[model samples]
Target: MKKEFLANLAEILEVKETDITPDMKLGEKVWDSLALLAVAAAFDSIYDKVIPVKTIGKCNTVQELLDLVEEDD
Candidate 1:
């Protein structure tokens, strides 16, 4: 599951697979609002759950998003 989430994030961020780490911040790079929306959409599509935008904002790292997704499960 973690691997899948990381892969999705890497795709969204347009970064190399090896660049994405649990400690990396999704918003740290130049990703704009559209990227975030795409990420949220990806989360819903893959996990069958809606992660509120506010929740995403509170997540500073990939691990935080993973925790949120796991908690939803």
Candidate 2:
């Protein structure tokens, strides 16, 4: 699930998978509202977890977003 999430995220952000890190800050130009929306959709489809966009918005880093995606997936 984590791999898939990272791959999907990399695709959404138009970056290489190796470029994304758990500790990476989401201050890049690619990390915009649209990306977050796509991430929300990906999370629901990939992990069957419907995380709120508002809740997701609170994430300041990749790890924060990853935290929202529990290991149960």
Candidate 3:
């Protein structure tokens, strides 16, 4: 799930797969908002879960986002 999430995120952000390290700060990216919305939509489509925007705002890394997705599960 984490891999899939990362792949989708990288795709949405137009970042290379190698560039999207788990430790990187998502909000520091210039394309964060669009990438985040894409991630949120992907979550809803793939997991049948809707992640709130506030929760999305609080997540800083792929691991944190994965944790939130797991918690939602």
Instruction: State each model's CA lDDT, in order.
Output: 0.81, 0.83, 0.76
RMSD of each: 1.5, 1.9, 1.7
lDDT of 3 by residue, 1-73 (tens): 7788777777778877777777888776645566668778877888777998768878878788777777835
Work out how many backbone clashes candidate 1 has. Answer: 0
Model 2: per-residue Cα lDDT at residue 39: 88
Query: Where does candidate 3 stray beyond 4 Å?
Result: none
| Deviation of model 3 at 5, angstroms | 1.7
lDDT of 2 at 1: 60
Best by lDDT: 2
The digit string of per-residue lDDT tens for model 2 on 1-73 reads 6777677789978899998888888885378889889889988987789999998888888888888997464
Clashing pairs in 2: none
| Candidate 1 C-alpha lDDT tens digits along 5-65 | 8898888888887898999876776467777687789879988779887777777888998
Scored by Cα lDDT, where does model 2 land?
Answer: 0.83
The candidate, 1 or 3, that scores higher on TM-score is 1
| Model 1: residue 42 alpha-carbon error in angstroms | 0.7
Q: How accurate is candidate 1 locally (lDDT)?
A: 0.81
